[model samples]
Structures are given as C-alpha cells and as structure tokens.
Target chain A: MRVELDVPKCVASGQCVMAAPDVFDQRDDDGVAILLEERPGEELLDDVREAVAVCPAAAIRLVEG
Target chain B: MSDALACPVTGASGPLPEYPLPRAAECPLAPAPAAQELRSEKPITRVRIWNGSTPWLVTRHADQRALLPDPRVSDDDLDPGFPYVNAHRAAIAPVSPRLITNTDAPEHTRLRRTVNGPFVVKRIEKMREPVQKIVDDLIDEMLAGPNPVDLLTAFALPVPSLVIAQLLGVPYEDHDFFQRSSSLVLDGSVPADEARRVSGELAAYLDNLIIQKTADPDDDVLSEMAGRVQAGEMTHTEAVHMGVAMLIAGHETTATMISLGTLALLQHPDQLALLRETDDPKVVANAVDEVLRYLSIVQTGVRRVAKDDIEIGDVVIRKGDGIIFDLHAANWDPEVFPGAQRLDIARPARIHQAFGYGPHQCLGQNLARLELQVVYGTLYRRVPTLRLAAAIEDLEFDHTGTTYGVHGLPVAW
Candidate 1:
C-alpha cells in the first residue's frame, strides 16, 4: 500500500515515527516527516494505520494498491 | 401557625452563613494565595463557583475522559466574553492568532494544518540524535558544576528550551528571551500590562525572524514556513503566530514535566530503581505515561464551551457555558485508575488525560513524549546516584499556574 502525507498539515509531533518508524522518518534539522517509501510492506499496515489515527492534524493517509 | 421553612438557593442558610462559595483565590491552585485548599473528596462533588453557580467537578478518570470531547461541550472561552478573566487574565493576554488550545474542529483543523509537519513521530525520531546530544550536553554542564545543583535551572529547563528554539530556527542565543517571556506569560499573577509588553516584544522578535527566514530560505521549518508564505499556502502572520505558540508550548510543558517527573521518580525510590534497570523502550514508554498521569503537569485542559444545552451526568449545562477538563483530578480518580494516587512506573494500560482526548488533543504530544523518554532514560543512567538536595516538605510546587511544576528542584548526586 502507498502512504501519502499532506505535508502542509503535519506538525512534526512524531506520532507517525513512533507508530511506524520504518515507513516514516524525520529530517535531521527541523524534524519534518520524510517518508522512506511511497508504498510500505503489507506487514506494516497496522502501524501505518495507527499513525493515521493518532496524527493530531490528520495529515497521513493510506493509498491501497 | 409557623410557616414552613424552605432552603433558598440564592440566600444565606441559617445562623452559620451559607457555605461560602469557593472563590478562585480559595481554590488550591489559586495564584493570589498560597494556602488554597485542595478539594479531593470522593464521588467528585460539585463545588460552589465564585461566578454565583456551582459546576460539577468530575474528579474521576472515567467521567472526565468520557466528557472531554463530547459534542455537547466546547473549548471556546470567548463565546461568553471570557469568563476566565478572574482566573487566567495574566496567562493569555494581547492574544495573537487564535491558539490550538482555544479552538475546536474545522477551525482548529485548519490552523493545525499550517505547521503539522514538524511534530510527526517519523520526523521526531530523526530528531532523536540531536535531542540526545542536547540532553548529553546539558548533563555535562550540570556535572561540571558542584555536586548539589539546581536541576531545574541546569538540566531540565535548558534541554527542552534549546530543542524548541532549534526547531523554530530561532537562535539558541535568544534562549533567555524565549524562556523569560514564556515564564512571565504562564505566570497567572503577572500584571496584564507587563505580560502584554513582554508578548509584544516576543512577537516583534518572531516577526523579524520570520522575515529573515523569508528573505533567505534554509532547511529549517521556519524557512519552510517562509517558503509556504511566498507560495500563498500560508500567510506571514500565521507563520509568526504558530511559531510563537510552538516555541512557548513546546518548551514550557516539557521543562515542567522533566523537573516534576524527576521529583516524582526520586520520591518513589522503588519506581526509580525499577526504571534504572529497565532497558526495554516499551517499558520506559509505559513509565513515561505513568509519570504524566501521576504528575499531570498541565493541571487542566483548555476550556471548552457548550454549543447547545447539554446534560453531563446529572447536571444540565446551558449553551455557551464554559467547561474545563481537570486533568489532574481525572488522572487521580479511583474509578478509572485503581490505586490512582500511587506512583507505579509499571502501571499497564494507563490512558492519561495529560494530552487531552479526541481531535483537539495535544499536537506536540509525540515530540513531548520523545523528549521525556530520552531525558528520563539518560538522566537515570548518567546520574544513578541522583537524589533530592532539599527535603520533600520544603519543595514549593507552582500549582497556582496553568502549568503545574515545582518552583525549583535542587538535586545532588
């Protein structure tokens, strides 16, 4: 599945990273989300979903293949 | 014939004047007086409000969490023309852009979207190294000094303050300005005029920073915001307001938690010992939640307003009525947290109200958690022999303000 983030909506709170580290990582300086891959492995679905749910700004979304 | 006597709700009762209503000054967390009483009764009784009516105090965990995000209630304090003036005048004055704390959905969602990128967990994890380095440097400075040091001034305050400053692309040299302004703004007793002056100065400084970032784009979030402004995605004023909010909220809450969390852990030696031995991140994570619940540094969630007449429990709240979710009282409620008062680092399945609930929950929670996890992990490991320098009774807790914290925490290793 592909994950798309509305970067403008993200606040860099790190909920996505804490929930799904493999798929999402932050930039070194300002701590903004830097997705590692557009489509992550199937096994990481639970975590990615949690990220979507917990994001205070509701910035993350899943694009199922 | 003797007339039947009835208890009048508005007038005095018998010879002993009716139970005097509880003024903000009489409230334990009041700023005017240091000797306010803490009403910790069972079943969560209603307290007579100074505003001439009584609002039910939902002291139990289940009740508060259940009602916090209820559609019937609201978070807007301005609908009734700011009733909290008697309570929070000094804390929020010379208001900038409407803050996340005061806004609800739609509007809140829109405002939060402007700068949500910096706080995502993935982004924050990338900050682990830098944050750890910041913590390490602060600790090094603390150890460089004498044995007994004020952890509040040295380690706890600086780490978060510097991290937040860096995140906003504000120079670390301006840490004093940010720290002082935040302190004054958060202090409920500060005069409104002084608070406004400080806020104006901070806003002007932030405005300058935003302009510089606009002129010369860089990798920092501020530069990104500047870029967005140029592209019409956001305005320069919006960026300034958000930046100021993030800087103030980011550092103030985390700094208070670190100091108070440490004090909590130190007081409970068994919990501290257990935390020291645990290497598992999950275990450490659970411990962080417990500390948040136990200390509840942010005493109450921001006020919410009732959009329409609503009934919470047995009480009927009229439209536009203001409600505050008492996080501290909720966290300590026995119905939700069995043995709620005890500080158990290993407490499992603990859901805390420290970050509020539903859509308006704290946007910076994850970053706050990451800071706490790193700070607590390194703190106990590096300063294994750490202990309080002053007696527990002597410690002065600043519960009078919105952010509850000890005035100073002196420690020795």
Candidate 2:
C-alpha cells in the first residue's frame, strides 16, 4: 500500500495524524499534511485506510495492490 | 398518512416534519426520535426549516460522508437556495465577507491555509501541558468556591474562554464581554436585530485587537493572521472576521461539551467510573469521542445548497435545492455504529461527525479534542465524588442555539 497526500488540498484538520501518525505529519508553519512514509509496513495498512476515510479535504489517497 | 395537510404559511401541500424535530424530554442526551426514524424511513428527505423552505435533510452517516465533500454541495450561504439556520443568518449572509465557514474550495482552500497552522495537531499538542494546568486550576477554583455551583459558569465556560483567549492573544480580562457577545451571536432564539448588533460588536472588538497585534507581533494565531495581512495574503477585515469566528466557534461549543458531558457521565455511573479510574490517556480520549457522539450537540444541521444536481440512491437533489445534514442523526446511524444509541465509551467511535465532515470540518477540532481530553481525563479523577446537584428533569436545555446544551449544570463533589 502506498499513501499519497495532496499538500495543497490539505485542510489540516489533522485526522491523518490522529489516525496514522507513523505515516503522516503536519508542517508546523501551514499545518498542511506531510507524508512521513510513502510506503509504510503492512502493519500500518488499517490505520492508513482510516486516514483516507477521515481526511476532511479528501487529500489522502491509498494505492492498494 | 395522506398528503392532506398544507403548510399554512407556504401553502405547500404535504406534512413535512420540521428540520429540527423536538427531542424527547426524558432522553435529553439522545438525538431527536423523529430524526432517527428518518434515517431508516427516508434517508434523504425534505424537512421544513424556519423560512418555510423544505430542504433535504440527510440523516444516514454513510450519505453525509459521501455528500459533504462533493463539489456540488456548497457552503456558500449567499446562494438563494442556501438553508439559513434562521432569519439572522439569512440577514447576515448578504453583508458577510467570505470566510472559511461560508466559501467553497479554491477560495476556502486559500483562506483556510492562512490560518490552519496554529490548529494543526502537532502545534496544538504542544499546548496540552498548559491546557492541563488550566483544567487543574479551574478544578481547584471550583473546589475552593461554593458547593453545588453552576458548573457552566464555574468551570465549563472558563476552560475554553481562557484557552481561546491565550491562543488568539486576546486579553483574558476582556473575556466576560466577548463571551456574552459571542453567545448572543450564536443564540438562534435571540431577535435578529439583537443578534446582528452583538455580532457587529464582536467584529469591531476583534478588528481593534488585530490592529494592536499587527503593530506588536506576538506568538499567537491572531499574530500569525496579522502577519498574513501584512504579506497581502489576507485583508485586515478578513483577519478580524476570522478572529471573531474562532472566538465564537470555539467558546460556547467547548463549554457546552464540558458541562453537558459531565451531566451525561453522572447519569451513567458505570461509564463515569471508567473515566474516573482510567490512567490511560487513550481510554480518556475514546471516552470524549463517545460522549461527543452521544450528545451530538450541534442542533442546527450543517446547511448547504446544491450547486448542481446530486443523485444518490433513488432520490435526485435538484440543482439550487438546499440540504441539511443532521449530525445528531448521522452520529447515531445504526449501520455505521451498531447499537448506535448506546454510549459505550469503549466503542471505536472516532469516525463520528461531531466536529462535522468535509474540507470545512472544524479547524479548531484538534484543539477542541485536546481541551476535551484534558478535561475529561482530569475532572473526573480529581473530584471522584463529583455528581449533579440538580435533577435531570429540572435542568433547562438550550435547543434554540446553534448548539444544544444545558443552560446551567449545578454540580457538587
């Protein structure tokens, strides 16, 4: 699974960080989401999916295989 | 039932249940029973609002999740079809400057970006210790003061007021004035003229504060916004309006949660015990979400106007039609949350739309959660004997406001 964050579309509500802190973080200045890891381990898949589901701006996408 | 009755005012034939159906007096914590029934009977059906307009009320959790982020659904209250919560909102819409609350993307995206930095989880998380101190001190003050005090005035109201004041760099000394003004602005029961007058006062207050913060920069959200105004990213008026918006948005809602959440916990001793006994921050955090889901306090369903026709399931929402997402109903949707009515603190309830859903979701959510987590985590633990001083039936609930909450919550430890 690969996680993609459209930085410009991010509203910075921080659900991604709350859902999958290991995979996403927010920049201190604008609070736009920054991907911590593009391809996290299989263990983090569920959390990543939750992040995609809850991202208010629909900024996060999951590339699943 | 036959479609015999006509709306006396509009002469629209049919019995459309009102958008905000009345909650059962006995079960004050639950969503309106009629609203819950609509989720199963007619997930997307029209309901009459204040202005005699029948807007489609979307009740199901799944439907709200799908529709809120759709481009066709607009937050632009300026649209003719936009369902204003009341006359005041309708009157204010024409003159109001575009802000994060009232604009669609590209515009909303640009405005929201300038202010989101301070509210991001990482930045807000840094305030946990200070917030904890605020909660602790408030509890201490409550302990020292009169017994069986109105918790609304004592603790619940001040926590967010002080925190928001500190965050916005507004003087805490001026909180009494702003708190009263902000509540008046949010109170739907207030006469439109009065609400508008108060709203103007708050805007003026913030406008002056922004001028001060601009000249003498401080480490705060308003200061950051002031800096943006200097950079020409946002206008002076937009910065001021945003300040008023944050204060009005953050103050009463958090206060309501604190006071009302306590009432809920007191009602369920077993759940209250879980919170009181828990040393785990995760447990407390989950408890806050559960209570938030249970209360679903924002009574004015999120209002939007359809920019284009939207089809879902068998129904077609025409372009220029209005839509209202009943958060209480959606939060209690059985498909998303099985045993939906039950307030199980242990339930996986983070998906709840208590802060709402979509790009315009609450910007102060991270901060709100932290404040709640701190309060829910600390208050119960510090005052283990804490219980309601007033009977449940006697307590007055403010149904007319944008958020539904108690007028006064008397408690004693």
TM per prediction: 0.76, 0.92
What C-alpha lDDT does candidate 2 achieve relative to the native structure? 0.86
Q: What is the lDDT of residue B97 in candidate 1?
A: 46
TM-score of 1: 0.76
Q: Which DockQ-derived CAPRI band holds candidate 2? A: high
lDDT over C-alpha atoms for residue B344 of model 2? 79
| Position A52, candidate 2: lDDT | 91
Q: Which stretches of candidate 1 lie over 4 Å from their true place?
A: A1-65, B1-46, B81-97, B172-199
lDDT of 2 by residue, B279-322 (tens): 99899989999989988899999999999999998999999999
Model 2 chain A worst lDDT window (10 residues): A1-10
Over all chains combined, what TM-score does candidate 2 have? 0.92
Could you report the DockQ of all the candidates, in the order they appear? 0.24, 0.84
Clashing pairs in 2: none
